[model samples]
Every structure is written in C-alpha cells, then in structure tokens.
Target: MLRDEIITVFGGSGFVGRHVVRALAKAGYRVRVATRRPHLAQDLRVMGVVGQVQLVQANLRVPASVERALEGATGVVNLVGVLNESGRQTFSRLHALGAKTIAESAAAMGIRRMVQVSAIGASATSLSRYARSKAEGEASVLAALPEATILRPSIVFGTEDSFFNRFAAMARFVPALPLFGGGKSRFQPVFAGDVGKAVLAAFERDDARGQTYELGGPGVYTYEALMRLILEAIDRKRLLLPLPWAIGKVIATVSELVGALPLMPVIITRDQLIQLQSDNVVADDAKTLADLGIHGETVEAIVPSYLERYRHHGQFHEREA
Candidate 1:
C-alpha cells in the first residue's frame, strides 16, 4: 500500500511472478526481481517506471547470493518453487532450504513484510515429495520469520499458464488428451492476476503477517470437465483418454528420462502424477480470494483470451476474448 517502498521478488521472471511484479510496479513500488539469471528476466524492467524495477542474479540455493539480493529491501516475496527435480534443484533444496534462506535473510535485515508462495496440497505427511518439501519450506519460513505471510494457491491459471496452455497446445496435434486418474480429481484454478493482487494485499495488511491464505478461482471443476472445457474453448475435438495411475506412472518415468534433455519439454513428473490423485479445491472454511476482498475471475473469462491462438483459425476464429 505504501508508495516508493522497495520490494524484492524472488522468481519474478516466472509465470506468476511477472503478474505480481506488474501489480507491485503499478502500486508505485520499487521492485527488485531476483532470479538465477538476471538477463533472462530483463523484460521485467519495463513493467515499472524507468528505474523502478531492477533485476539481480540470485539463486535461493545459495545463502550468500540471497543476502545480496535483499540489500535495502523493505519487503521480500519468495515466489521461487520447483515442480520437478533437476540435478541439484531437488525439492528439499529449493523448496525447503531455499525458502529458509530467504526468510532468515529477510529477518536478519529487519524486513518484516515477507510473502512466500506455496501450493495448495503441501503437507508434511503427504506421499508426494514435492508436497512434503513444500510443507517443510513453509515451516522453515515461519520459523525464521514468524511475520511472513504464506500464500497457497491451487492450480493458478493465466494467459501464459502451463496448465491451460499445455493442454490446449496438445489438443492442437495430439490425437488424445491423457486424463490422469481417470480425470476424476477436482481443482479450483485461480487467475495469475488475482494471485498478484493477493500478494500485494497481503503485504499491505498488518494482520496478514504470520497468516496463511489459500487462493482459488470462482469455480471448481473436475479434471475431465475442465479438459472438455478446453477442448470446447479451442474449438477442437480430440479423444479424452482416461489414463490409469499405473500407466501414468510408467509414462511419468519415461517422461522424466526424456525431460533431462537440454531443450526437452516439461513432462509430467511422478510427483505430479501422484498429485493428481487428490482433489485440489480449497478446504472447507478456509480463507480464500474473497477474504482478500478480490473477486477472483473465473477460468471461463480468462482462458479463451490467449487460447485462441491454438484454434484452427487462430485469432481469426470468432470467439470471445
């Protein structure tokens, strides 16, 4: 809420972080986008006034680099998270340890306003390593900086999202869209723009510190229904194959192997396959986007805006934006 405040955002170059940066910049805040490679996120510089947004090369895995990134920052937002392990970027290292370093560093620098972005299914006792690591990361962050706000989002969707875009792209050429666990799992997808606003609101509210908020969209849809919606949105028809967990795991294994290539597309990891077994809707009685005073946009309104490119006639096709 305060103008001219300095806020450093980790993972500002990511799908969700870009929107968050834009929101912060529009709020008249000086934002420092810290990522592993500063050059890759150069576009973030244009999101704010001439010099309001700056980029710094910092990897969460290293404490020293994180310390340097937080110099002269009134607040910090950790949007850094990994879906799959790639060599040293494992779950424990990035999610758990990386989060701790940021929180502790912020605390050391007397930065009271810190927000950490976590997933919806994070649990210490979860069967999935990613989930467990996320739990560990949350615990680590709170332990270090008790005032830090923790945000847990369920399937964040946006113009450049991996969820809607991936499936829509596959529908372009793939004969069938694989439905994990018979596509029975349910999800409450949130818009990235809403999430960005949520981050800003959390930082402005004093009560938000030390609190955890679960963010989701207006509607909850089953995986199969969502797939059908995407098929309809793109104006394309394709087989909707219900893949068994056993078969999905095998494909996940092969995908992981192939994903190691330098330019390989991100395939479904085994942990992601496991994540599909459970529903990702907001918990009963849990706080949500409404709690932040944000009327989260529905997937119906946002998805078609960008997914039109995947259609047969691209944007030439007549459909709602």
Candidate 2:
C-alpha cells in the first residue's frame, strides 16, 4: 500500500475507535491504531491481513507522541473523548488543545482528509463541560484543516457500549432504574458500526470536506422508553423511577466518589447527569444516514441480540420446552 493510503486513528482501542479501524481496514486502507497502551488492541489484527493494521503508543497530552502517531499517515481520525474530567486529562487539554495539535500535525504532514468525531450537543456555550470541549475541538480541527470533515454522533450504541451495558447490569442489582429529568429526554442512539462506515466513506469523498454531519439512528426514543426497552431485553420488570434534576445531581456526586475506587462504580457523575438534561438526537436540517447512502439500524433489531445475556435465563430462557 502507498504511504499516503495509511490512516492513523487516535484512541483506536476505545469503543468507537475499534469499529472505525475495522471499517477502514475493510476499505483497503492501512490502519495505524494509536493509543496509550497498544497491546490492548492486539485483537484488531484479526480485522485485516497481517501488517495491514499497526498499533503504536500515543498520548494526546504529549505533542511529540501525537506527532509520532500521525507520522507516515495520509489521513487521521480522532475518537478520543471523556464523559468526566480526570487528573491531567481535563476537557480543555484533551478535547480542545489536543485536537488542535492533531489537526495541525496532520496538516503539516500534508494530510488533508481528516475526520473528527465530536458529540451531538457540542457548543461553546453548552452547560456540560463535555459538550463545550467537543465544540472547541471542532473549531480547532476545522481551523487547522479547512477540508476536515467533522461528524457529531448522538449517543452511539453497540454490543460493547457502556450505556446499555451499564443499565443491564443495574437491573441485576437494583429494584428500580433511575431516570433523570423524568425520563423525558430523548436520544437517537446510532450504531457504532454505522458511524464507522460513514467515517471511512466520508474520508474517500471530497464532497464531505468542510461539512458537519449529525449522525443518528432511524428512530428516536425517550429516556423512559429506552430504559423500558433495555429492561424488556434483559427480561427484567424493574421500575423506571424518575428523579428530579437536583436529586439526581446529588446521587451522581456520590457516585463519582465511588467511581474513584479501584473498581468501577455502580452510578455515574453530576456532569453526566447535567448532560442527560439535554436530549441527544440529530437535528432535522443536519446531514443524516440517508445523506451518506446508508440506512440507519433500529435498536429493536440489534439490542436483543447482545442484551439476551442479561435476560433471566440467558438465551435459553426464551426457548420452548
């Protein structure tokens, strides 16, 4: 393969990054998966022929490391993001400054086609720090590379997604699943694969350059409806309790503390709760799945396939005697 045909994917070991890498590989593009720990992405080797996908260590906080990751690449895709800020990985540094560095590096290397994975609610004035950082990242990427295509997906879902898995696990322990803001918040839950394919498609199409696409699934669901669907998929009849925003924030604060432990926590954070206050769905006027010549997948069709494990008796539970 030509050197310029290689694509460097930052955060390729992450939930969305893995799918993007697989999609790029299938498109006959050599992939360089950049992450802090490259060993964790060894499984990606199966996505393509030997030597087609290479793994390398890259930390967004370090410009030299980021440059090394982007070295010898024709294009780049940034999938690094965080729901909560942590020590040395603040939203400003990782999403904003880090994004600027990557875009500049790619431009300096003569890589014009870049895809930046941002979130749906990205805005400079957004209340959620996550959203603000994402917006900043978009601005920085676009300014650095005017031809960059930025994709903002709304609450991407997949078999290994943290959202559905977290709720399914909760149904196993809690009698009721808490729904923030009366469960009225809506979401468009696009599949991770669809987004990945779209990224690769966009990378190949010059028409997509300088455009911002809002990717979402075919159907939209309220928070309560989503929870119910998850419960039904898991074969659990847990109550969907709606909590006020104030109370939810308090609970989330406590949960953040618990999450600091060596093990994962059972709950989320106040910032996450604040994020829930805003709906996560594609805008009507924005470019969508149909525009990319790809039809969106329904949650009903995909959720049950993986969520069956959370059912009372697993797959066998629904079998007729």
Candidate 3:
C-alpha cells in the first residue's frame, strides 16, 4: 500500500538520516528531507521513486524554517546531532535547543508522531558536555510531545560511520593505536539500518509511542576488542598501546588546541575522552530493538564488506581466516 502520509526528517542527508530516509521511502511514505542545504542532498531524491523523496531548506537553529519544513507532515524524526563542536554548533545549541525547537514546532503543527535519536551514554550529570546535552534534548522532546518515541542507540556502525571507519583508516598508516583507559570501556554497536527500521516501527506500532528504546547490536565488545576486529578485518597487525586516562587527556588537550586552527581535524577532544569513560551498552531492563520487533544485525556480517576498501589490496588480497 502506497501511504499518502509525509514524514519530515530533519538531518535526512546525514549518515544515519540516509538510512532512515531509505527505510521511509521503501515503506511507501513520502519523505521530505529538511537540511540546511537542499542542493547538496540532491542524491537523496533517488532513494525512492519519482517525487517520493524531496529536499527542503531547513535550519534547526531557525524556528521558522523548522515550522515550514513540517508543513503538511504527519510525523517528524530528529536525527540531527554533532560529535564535535565548531563555531556556533556547540552541543547545547544543536542537541538541546535544536531538539526543543523541532519538538515544539512539530507539536504546534499538530504533528505528534515523532522520533528523537539520542546516545546510550546520555546523562544529565555526565562530565562530557555531549552526553549531558543529549540528556537535556531527550527531556525537551518528551516534555513537548509526551507520546513521542525516544531511541537511545549505542555507537552506531555502518559503511559511512565515523567509529569503525576512523580506526580502520588510522590502521592504514599509524604504527600503533592508542587504547585510552586501556580500552576497557564497553560498547554495543548498533547497525544504522536497524536503527532506521526501528524508526519506521515507531511510526507503525502503537505501543512504541511514549516508550524509550535502547537500540544495540546482538553482541557487546570492548574498545580493545573492537580495535582488534578492525585490524583483523583489514588483515593487518599493529601494536595496541594502552594509555592511562591522564596521558589520554593530555593528548586530547593538544588535539583540541590544534583543531582550533582552520581546516585542522581534531583527532580527539577531552570531552570525548570523558565520554569514553562510560559504558555505551543497553540496560538489561530497558526496551531494545527486540522490543520493536527488529533483530539487530551483527558487526561480523556487515562490517567486513565495507571495510574491504581498507584492506591492503582493497578486497583483492586473500583475507586471513
């Protein structure tokens, strides 16, 4: 059945947003991708048939633009988030205030069906500003639309994910990878596509409303184990240097300072280091992907395929068993 409902997805041009948009298109819902630059997101139109997906200019910082984006929309999905702060894009502005704006805008437009994506380690009292902002955003969303579904996903992994892809790229040149805090912090990496499906489920299922779901993968692994998995995938060997938190903080501080320079990429920040101190796994009693009828994909099944590009010969070399 071709649904006539339209879903406005803020940040629909992003990595996770791409998956969500594709899922929405495949589900026969008209998708309006709201982004700051609609021209840059022209490729998203092909995800569906002619006129199934359209892009509109919308900046979360601008409340009027957000309201305009929700015009004639039955639901909204807030997938906009930033891992690093730059200029006016601080964690508080984008995560907390931006979310509140979207949620409030959706509510004013009589759009109740919504999904707010958050991180698993989000805590109001966390040392990391990112996590604390995420927690604040969750609160704002629920306060505005109590029936909106909130999804807190662990480190999400996919072809374009920064997590796995970052390390795999580093292994290509770096002699050794640093294990901050001995890499003991655990994570339950969830597949981006599965999270997309969960977004669709949130709209389709009645019980999903007003519920908070913790989306995670089938297995949990430590930071060290994850690094090992990346090295194994590329069939490469490298030293795993275990660094204490103090040393890691120092490195992060320098990285942040250097990152202040124009065009300089920040490898890590002190705030991100603080975030790594906490475990990013689903709570035992919390509702999960299974609760939404989604069977989370395993990292082994999906990661290796995309990681082939990082191989020495780019998938031509025979991988070790």
> What's the ranking of the predictions by TM-score, best on top?
3, 2, 1
Task: Score candidate 3 by lDDT.
Answer: 0.95
What TM-score does each of the candidates earn? Answer: 0.96, 0.96, 0.98
* Candidate 2 positional error at 282, Å: 0.8
lDDT of 3 by residue, 1-321 (tens): 558999999989999999999999999999999999899999999999999999999998889999999999999999999999999989999999999999999999999999999989888999899999999999999999999999999999999999999899989999999999999999999999999999999999999999999999999999999999999899899999999999999999999999999998788899999989989999989999999999999999999889989999996988667
Would you list the clashing residue pairs of candidate 1?
none
Stretches of candidate 2 off by over 4 Å are: 1-4, 319-321
**Best model per lDDT:** 3
Expressed as tens digits, the lDDT of each residue in 79-167 for candidate 2 is: 98876777787889888988999999889888888999998999999988888999999999999899999999988889899888889
Please provide the root mean square deviation of candidate 1 (C-alpha atoms, Å): 2.1
Q: For each predicted model, how many residue pairs clash, with residues at least 3 apart or on different chains?
A: 0, 0, 0
Model 2 has a clash total of: 0
Q: How do the residues 12-32 of candidate 1 rate in per-residue lDDT, one tens digit apiece?
A: 999999999999999889999
